[model samples]
Target: MFEKDQDKEEWTLSATLESPASVIASGFGLDTAVGEELIVVKAIRGEIYAYETDLSTGAWLLSAEVSVVDSSYVSSRPWNQARDIPSLFQRVFLIRLED
Candidate 1:
């Protein structure tokens, strides 16, 4: 998580997840297994985002907006299927405006 420092005109790190395993276990109600692959899903102010990471190197792979309904997380649609939709950042900005 991050917060913008208006005076500095930059984003600052706010908080972080100490244990991704615990978070995934609680939030998604799934127990991780050895050598299992997983994607982390985070909800910030009711908006859902997913982060894919390389388990071996801890490198970030991708981040995308996701939809959650009835405890299910829907992955982003393929580009070909979502050509008409606004980009993720644009949609997030629009949501902030609505708020």
Candidate 2:
């Protein structure tokens, strides 16, 4: 992406070693609930999956299958309007379960 008034930045898209799976992912939610490093992907199949970084291969691996019924990401955050968090909570910690 570029702006009309700004200088153009040239870029190229290339295939990388670290890439997502073939399935169509509807949305993404970061699982910082317990200070664990995980990337969560909500697939089109109505299933949630958590992925972890494979240090040796520089790629992501499936860590766990998050149950949508019990997982707070979809059930709590997406619909709940009063879940706004402060910057301090975000900086020092992540996803305070209480507030």
Clashing pairs in 2: none
For candidate 1, write residues 1-99 as lDDT tens digits.
345545643332222333433221221222221112334433344353444445455434223534343222323322111222222222221111000
Where model 2 places Cα greater than 4 Å from the true spot, the runs are 1-36, 59-70, 73-99
Clashing pairs in 1: none
| Local distance difference test, each candidate | 0.30, 0.28
TM-score of 2: 0.26
lDDT of 2 by residue, 1-99 (tens): 211223432221112222232111111222232223433323223333334433343333334445343234533543222232221121111111111
Displacement of residue 7 (Cα, Å) in model 1 is 16
* Model 2, total clashes: 0
Give the worst 10-residue stretch by lDDT in candidate 2: 90-99
